[model samples]
Target: MSEELGMREEPRGRLYRVTHRTVYEYDDDVTSSYGRGFLCPRDFPGQRRIDHELVVDPEPEDSSTGVDAFGNHDLYFHVTQTHRRLVVDAQSTVAVAAEQTSWANWDDWADWEDVRLRLAQEPLVRQYVIDLDPPEITDEVLRWAAPTFAARRPLVEVVAELTHRIYKELRYDPGSTTVATKVSEVLAQRSGVCQDFARLAIACLRGHGLAARYVSGYLLTNPPPGQPKLVGADATHAWAAVCFGEDRWLAFDPTNNQLVSDEYITCAWGRDYADVPPLRGVIYSEAKTSTIGVSVDVAEL
Candidate 1:
């Protein structure tokens, strides 16, 4: 699918009513299915999830909620009843903080190299800061990110420039790539959706020995003047966050070429897309074909 969600929002802050609906249609009936969703917004420094609920059609035989290792809300459910389609609807009321004034103080931070070495000794930050999978460090990624890692450059400044470079170079074509597309491929193709850009950024940062993680969320969108924002027109969005030693992880939206602010609503994050897909499931079916449809609506509340 389509990755879109969020309402018209202001930089100061706003509470939103978010609804995300996903439907899966299979050619043959699916006797059973086990699914997971990372649909709950996280409570962080300036963001708070007030209330949330998830509904599964045909009612699941069993369901429970828990927090993932990365601290995201993870929901698990299984359906035993035979069905040709499955629907998951998630709704939330979230209060997002205004853009932080602290961003302006980034210039006073330690150099990129210092932050890298600091995180290197911190065992807990290893997994996210290091490239362990498809977004492996390649010469190509290193070359692309080299310019941003100049000596003594403030860590935040380096990432901000890198984020700018990616946004300027990559084309956001929905069908150009899939969830399986690797950062190396994205580098060669120079195009992809939010997820692709996010992963690419993660690789680039890790290539330079910085800690970065993929973030999944919703972005408030604006329609052209005189046009109504269509329901489901907005899809889930993705971005990247880089650690600056200590407990700080600054978020960047290479997809939109901006630092994350109140306009962004974070849901979950992990090493990459595979770690936290909005919705994924295993189904037992003879169907040779399956199609997914997603709809999202985010209205100011």
Candidate 2:
């Protein structure tokens, strides 16, 4: 059964009140295993000086649920503001509560070679692989990265396990790096934020001959009863997805050491953080400070 998903965004403390135009795109294509929706910035055309670009398709990678005999419905919303301290927010509500299944169950069924071969036929996805030139499976990197996962694992399992190991080996500090930070730099410090974890995972997956992409979105935090939702927890999160086999991709969160579940809501995706930013724009104001706030709650259907 699909669960209902909803997103709400509010902007406060505006510096500019310029009129903006935005678009929301949704795919009702039932043939595809994954349906996509997009939201564009309102005044992005006018304020191009900020070098801003928003990330869409931030959810973990998986097959389109549209074709599943079970039938799944997903919904998303995007909000944009043009005025002063640009405050852009987005919320996505998905109706299908994907069950929490063991990673092992998918191991035997998924075929990486077949997926890579088939994906080569698709122009866009194939171009992603060609353009990225994901890592080659060499003796050294494999040996070093191999120890990161348990024995007798699928490629996806290895990727997931290694990603978790990388997360555990690193620290979750903010100022340590920026979205533009390099994967090598993140590895050097062995500590960073969600974005860092995503970059690291992408880099590692690519090195292992897998096409992995970065995603930015919101996660439904396990909020305590009666207590208010956490501030930054609901704000923005980053994760990575790896192309397994046969055009099938799986979502993995190294930062959380788990696969994405119902609590995860995606907003955008891209080659890296530069592709998808929560809020980005240029302002005429000389001095500016920005603040972000987020809240999320889930009720059982």
Candidate 3:
């Protein structure tokens, strides 16, 4: 559903070259269009940004590049030329972040409830964990996440446990849900794509009064054994990151059921998918419909 949502858009243990291309075709001429997105990879802690570039077809009359409130690089553009097709191409070279996550290392870690209490006083992380809009957190969501937030369990442990549970129980059906699907609906359906899974995990954390964020990026997907890797076969990936305290965060991929490592690249992170989608735009035209296609490739260098 995320890919269909808007082909949302990461590896650093090793240097990587990532290419993302989005093409829009309109049924009739479009007089103007305005777009905003995260085309350049973010320079987060433990991550290195080597080089990056973005190209817009039809040559936008106005454009700007800057960092958003979340400190991620963002691009804004407006195309005024009359055209039937528009293209956005972004290429980035980056060295990925590598972090080893252990399940048995909780000696000094605070309890899940303790972390939640600490977060209640934090304003910096509140932006990422707040779930007021769309009503992602509900009674049902809390009830479903109740078992995982056990009494005095470590925060990271609770996060990882939910990650595994989602991966094991829910099916990864591409079309199971849509961009508008809520966490409650996803919980009831029991299946969805990366965005849905990531959102669900985030809802669980917020229900416990913890701060969790939605991550958008690219993941390296392998081909079947003995088969050549297909160019642009890799997809835009997503995951959830739980803020244990003000100083640290642990990210987990529920769809892949693992701790994020060098294989995943960081693009932009926000409270949810709507905040940092790869590309979203508004067009002024008489065109009745439009089609979008996104192609992504992650090559290790």
Ranking by lDDT: 1, 3, 2
TM-score for candidate 3: 0.90
Local accuracy of candidate 3 as per-residue lDDT tens digits, 1-301? 0111122223335777888999999999999999999867877666667778888999999998878888888899999999999999998877876765555553436899888888878888887667857588999889998999999988878887999999987888887888888889898989898899999999998877889999998875554478554222367888888887755888888987878877677899888888899999999999999999998888778
Question: Which one is best on lDDT?
Answer: 1
TM-score of 1: 0.90
Model 2 root mean square deviation, Cα atoms = 13.8
Query: Which segments of model 2 are wrong by more than 4 Å?
Result: 1-93, 107-123, 130-153, 224-232, 288-301
Clashes of each: 7, 27, 4
Q: Write the per-residue lDDT of candidate 2 for residues 40-140, one digit (tens) a residue.
A: 21211111111112222322233222211111122232222222222222333233334334576565434445455556666555434532423323344
What C-alpha lDDT does candidate 2 achieve relative to the native structure? 0.48
Stretches off by above 4 angstroms in model 1 are 1-12, 99-107, 222-233
TM-scores for candidates 1 onward, in order: 0.90, 0.60, 0.90
Question: Scored by CA lDDT, what does every candidate get?
Answer: 0.82, 0.48, 0.81
